[model samples]
Target: MRGNTLSYGTRYLGRIQGIALLVGGAMLVGGCARLRPTADGELLGDDAVVAHARLLQMADTRAMDTLLVRQALAASTPSVRAAAALAIGQVSGRTLNHLARSLLADGDSAVAANAAYSLGLLRDTASVPALTGALGGRQSVAVEAAWALGQIGAPSRAAIEDALSKAALPEPVLASLLLATAKLRPVPVAQLIPFLRHSNAEIRWSAAYPVSRTLAPAGVRAMLDAARDESAPVRALAARALGRSATGDSLAAEALGALDTLARDSSAHVRINAVRSLASYGSAATTAVVALTADRDANVRIATAQILGTVLPPQRSVWISAWNADTAFMYRRSLLVSAVRAGAMLPALSPASADGWASHADWRYRAAAAEAGGSARSSSALLENALPHVGDADGRVRLAAYTAFATYADSSRFAWRNQILVPALNDPDFYVRATVLQALGSRASAAETPGILASYQRALADSLNDARIAAVRYLAAAWKRDSTNFPDSVRAMVQALKPSDDPLVRAEALESSIFSSWIAAPPGRRRLDWYQRKVRSVLLPALAGRPLSATIQTERGAMTVELFSIDAPLTVDNFASLARAGYYRNVQFHRVVPNFVAQDGDPRGDGNGGPGYAIRDELNRRRYGRGAVGMALSGPDTGGSQYFITHSPQPHLDGGYTVFGRILDGFEVLDALVQGDRILQVRIR
Candidate 1:
């Protein structure tokens, strides 16, 4: 079932501050005063700046540092004071909530903004009153306070409704409030509906955000009217609203007609959203998809391809024609990959042609070919094409080939699990090795237990903790499928448990040792002792340090991020160490989901590439707000090179994924990032 739903990339759902511009005088809002460093003689002014810088550099906070942060918060300079407020929030978490609340009304706007944003991170619900008042401050502080209110959710609902009902508010403040209101449950639709016809496009979109979420009849009618609004953004918002309210009955005939008209709108964004909404209609909207597949916008064509892959079976020819006609490289690549993911074929391309395309100079083409090789319908002539690519120079292509071999291989004719997949269990890339282990578990039969056991043995000795974890799973599945007398499986699991530095590996092995009846010798209690000691020595220390900062340089611009060193130290170290080694240099963002996330850090330009190891998750109370940077996990601790930045808040990911970092600067860059955008390098400062 997992492989059947082919995700082009892992969507690790776990599922910030405008710090850089305000602190550095980078010109954010017009006429806003700049924050400056305090004079040397001012009490703790110079010391505060130095301490703040050091605080930012630390991967985890020490108790002694809290005194220094508190002292800095009293500094004369607003910038130093602002930095200290942020540092205090980062170090103390919710312990210093009262002090941060007091700073919300600080004389300096920068200080107020920092305090507001930090409260959002701390999830200080009781401070909603103070935060709402700050929304009447300067534009910068108001925006930050608005975001904090949204983070507080249900607690701020009463205060926000009261504010909106009062005297007419400024557009900036109103827009932010509407945006924040959309994030809360039990949305105030009665109040929000009036804004549907707001003169400003932003307010209209903000209104649509919650309106689309509720999908009430009135909201749907409002959005239908909005679809015909003169502004492109309003139309785009209407399309998204329609898409979210995709229930068969909710998508009325009038609404569908409006969306079909918008699908041909002049704006590519509107068209993209319109086509995306049309996907939820299935075969009923086949005519719209057929026409949009040849639209001028490449993104529209790409979205149409995705719809065709899942919705209509007969559109296989149309999908292939669009793929062939697409001039945009990323669009073409998405079409082919998505087709394979949906188990659909490009009817126009022959197996010989697919083989030739697989060998094309571009790695994207090869990755597509590898995924296609797994499709029985597409691989009739190209079945053997992906076989040799198991050792392809590019890790992305090699990974795709392995998936193809495991998923679509002729079990009777080929011993892929033993010959190709088993051997690749020792692959240099951690992602490749892990994927091979999963493939073996899913595809290997009872007769192949011996070969799988041999591969599991190799995996336990692997340098990366990810490979070792995979070995435990592979052995468990193999044992479940075919019961054998090989005591080595238990021995190997025990060996992985003791003296292992990775806590995740130890945990897995301990679970197998205690619950599994397979292990014949060595009592489970004794094994637990060894595992507990290994955890105490290895994992605890890494988690106790302060957070660190990294500067990611993309082709567009540079953005600074504060890695959650204390909460997810192992994950932070893995990313920082990889960045230090130039692991992310010149890597392409292989996947970009509009209004969701932009994912990158794969050297092979495919979503599956990773460093030679994996790190265990360090999930915490951190919510996935816009600009939240977290590791991309396949399932459980599968996080590696891939990371994503959320374009909007994602509540569904809460308690489900790891939140490791938050973007401190240049968040605008994330909105502009598209598939194939390159990361020039990542510097762990």
Candidate 2:
């Protein structure tokens, strides 16, 4: 962990060193404890102890934990009560809502904070008064209460406005209040302006968020002032807001000056966002683009490359030359691929240049080249060159090749699949096999049926859950495309949804069966119901109260995160189960977007790999701040193993990705992580 993180831990009781000991002690004492209350009426009974122990176990089966949750809620121990309050949200029982509401005034601060957080998840509007009351208190409780009010939405607007009207609140509390209030549909931007000019940078930045979104003409001065603020984060926020303003061109001169200044800011985060904002101004940012390309930060250079590709077409050679001259191909390969893909200059580039990269000594470059081939700008020659890498020795390169070829191999295009994709169906890597199957799914033709069916059958028999999922999806798509040609495919898909131990595989099978059909027949509906029943029965029990902690053993060092089982149980369960199954072992941190995130957990050691099935999104009010751990989904509910830890607070991703956990220790370890760093293992505690 970073030194500052270590010092921060010393002050933050939540990150206390003996957390494991505390948990273990709670469990041990409860094992033999009997039902008895002290004369003081503060002692926990055996039932309460047992309930607390069960809740602490982090059970995956949330729906079945209502009784235990109720018992723990009444427990005398503040920790037990806090844990229960959090659990109430996961269980999602109306009966527990009043209990959570009552805990909003719990004597202990932690219990109160958790209660507010849970009530938000429950969206209990009735708790508005209590939440608002808590907002005038300490930072921890206030942040949670304010966030809860936001989740309560329109109903809590008046209460939030009233809280903001009060004077001299702590910066953390006020900032959170502003953030929470901005999330409400009708943000009180007029009331927020004074705080925008507040001496405190945090409050200023928080005030800027809603103003930027609204882009009210009155807020322009505040935005401009914030752009020149001493704080890098505040400057970053202002710079971002300037780019989003409707009157961007009118404010171009001042905004550009701020952007240029912020682009060279001391903080890498400020510089990154400044460049991204510059890109948003279109060609108007051409002058800034040239300076950004030569930026000291590698990520800035990468983002600059992506921007110049679209806005400065004349810089094509400059971009290509930079790529060729950069000696650190291994480190720069992923960024280069992203840059190339964003630049859309592949078609204009020489086939020889693409070939050289495709055949590079580094597998990452080859993999990247394969990915680049999928882009619309890529030439047929590039695609052809990428095909050879499909059978390349590296599994990651092969996966990328399959992905690229799949993108290029549309149903209208026939020759490439037979030449490259067909052979990949039998590839040793299950992901490669799955990708190939996925590619063939959309091809509409009677001629492709037999081979596709054979491949589908092979995939269904494969041991990997992802492979089975791919097969079921392909079957559904194929059945939809040509019922006459693949008459049994739909029926086969429905049959695959039968009682299964694997929730991921069954979930995918059900989705493909129900949604893939062009017309949902009565039979399909019945099948969907059957599949739903099977899934709920098989998954929920295993999911209940499963305690989850992940020991992310990175190359730098090991860090443990106590997954937030109550708030985001599904995400926690997915991560914990995968860790226990050794899925994340040896996976590399594939993408490290500086000052943004350090992402890993793809088995392919590339961003594209997953367990092949997506779970429901458990989006919550949790902020994506530094050390926050979240599932890295491409879209809603797409998370599966691939997760990221934030380097700094990322407000933009707050409601987008599911924040399931936080780094309990090892901030330095997460800070030190970079692309290509291997996760030695992710031990589930």
Report lDDT (Cα) of residue 505, candidate 1. 50
Per-residue lDDT tens digits for candidate 2, residues 42-148, read 44444444454455343323333566666666655654576677766644555778887787777787787777777877788888888887877767888888877
Cα-based TM-score, every candidate: 0.66, 0.73
Give the alpha-carbon lDDT of every model: 0.63, 0.63
Off by over 4 Å in 1: 1-10, 13-46, 57-65, 129-142, 244-247, 310-312, 315-320, 327-329, 337-344, 347-350, 354-363, 373-394, 402-424, 436-589, 593-601, 608-685
Residues 1-685, model 1: lDDT tens digits = 0111213223342100000000111111122132322232233222333443343332122222545556666655454576666654444457778888998888887777778877876678888888988877788777777777877889898888887786567787786777777667777878888988878877787677677766567777778888888877678778876763543474568777887898888877678778888877777777887788777654567667656654566446756666676667666656665566565666323455644566678777777777666654444434555676787888777878777766664553255455677688667665677777777777434455555445555665554454656666665555555445436655454344333334455445556433243333331112223322322232233323324688989988988898775455556766887888988899987777655677776665656445645544445445577788877765655566678777655544544467888888987687667678899999986
- Candidate 1's error at 229, in angstroms? 2.8
TM-score of 1: 0.66
Error of 1 at 277 (Å): 1.1
